[model samples]
Target: MLKDKMKEVMQYNSILNQPNAQGRYKNYKCFHCKQMGHIAKFYPMDYKKEVSDMKKDTKVQGFKASKSTELITYPKIIHFSTTCMIKDTDLTNWDKIWYISDQINRHVCYKLDNFYNIKEGFSVTKLKNQKKFLFTYELGEVLIEESGKSIMILGMYYAPEVTLNILSLDLLEKQGFETKYDGNRCTLSLIFKDKEVHTFDEDRMKKMHNKYLQDYFESLSK
Candidate 1:
């Protein structure tokens, strides 16, 4: 009688194992959490926690992510453009220019000829050890606009004509903005005083600057 009862129980379990309308068994196991009765997609996951953890890790590692193609969004971005000069001679003649952002720089720099009307009371100093093998002669303030917001940036006029105006990473951080870097891309975001701003894709901007530098160097070699 015990053997017969055991066989009946097995038969009932076999009947319960029949496929459902979705072609999955009634006792389907979730592929994600490995729990019974659901699939991977239906599994409940704490996506917010996962994302928060990821961002925390990113912050702990100096705000640099490993992925090259990752898209990082910021709350605010300041956009500006500057003209490039060859041989540092005609600074006023604006022909070709490119947009650029420097993640490692501390100050904005402009060619002397770019600013036509200059006030007499500005200080001029010889700045050395600049990146892209450039040097600066004069330092002054320039009023720049981004998203209708006007901010003054202390700009240095470099001896060599530069085709790009740089947004300084160090200065941005000092202004309460957070900087994040992923591969060639850099992002500056500010979240303070209940305000947010994000910049554009820095990877593309940096690449354009690098291309200009390469061409400049190549022309010099020629």
Candidate 2:
């Protein structure tokens, strides 16, 4: 029943080749935000939805749609993003491309080069296929950036298949950081103790990632 409804909705959304086809779903209204063309469940603002007890099964399970622009149901912990940009910071005109999830559980990262002291052997199942698994591991405390405020993650996981950089809201607050979500505003999401903190910078982290990779590959030749 729901699949049929979703099919009908997709037809309208595909007309303009846009996420939301304007004037297409005029009759559709979101009860949460009182917006048109989508419902509260499909609101891409947070890109979150309800799922089973993923936290109990694994710290970092498979998440979100394959494409950045494809919105779908996700776990409570994951603010599965179709867009690589953070939704909260988009309004401010920041060109940063890293994504921030309001994930209620553990945080997860995409690259091994970006992490240190993390144990491997952990695996994550894909959201679409529970049987398939991707190997990753626990991120105890990783310095995402080596300089310029030095953004760090408290508790996170590493998945090789993941593309976008992700942070766990659960461990972030437990690690002495606070977030402000004004219902829908969700502005200034990260803060250290009392002071406001900005999200991780992409360029700096990329530099650190490259450095790690260079050292790793160099050691292999030894």
lDDT of 2 by residue, 1-222 (tens): 998688546544543454454565657876644656665545543222222344335534233223346442442232244312333434332222335465325566665445544654565645543344444565544554311334556566765455556665555666666655444333222454456566879999999999999999999999
lDDT tens per residue, model 1, 1-222: 997687556534543453451456436775544546545454334433554677767633112223446443522222333222112222334432212344335454454433422333333333343322444445555434333343444443433334355655556567676655545444344547464576689999999999999999999998
**Model 2: lDDT to the true structure:** 0.51
TM-score of 1: 0.29
User: Cα deviation of 199 in candidate 1 (Å)?
Assistant: 26
How far in Å is the alpha carbon of 166 misplaced in model 2? 0.4
- Which one is best on lDDT? 2
Which portions of model 1 show Cα errors greater than 4 Å? 1-103, 113-133, 155-160, 177-222
Off by over 4 Å in 2: 1-79, 82-97, 125-134, 180-222
Candidate 2's TM-score: 0.36
- For residue 205, model 1's alpha carbon misses the true position, in angstroms, by 34
In order of appearance, the predictions have TM-scores of 0.29, 0.36
Instruction: Estimate the lDDT of model 1.
Output: 0.45
**lDDT of the candidates, in the order given:** 0.45, 0.51
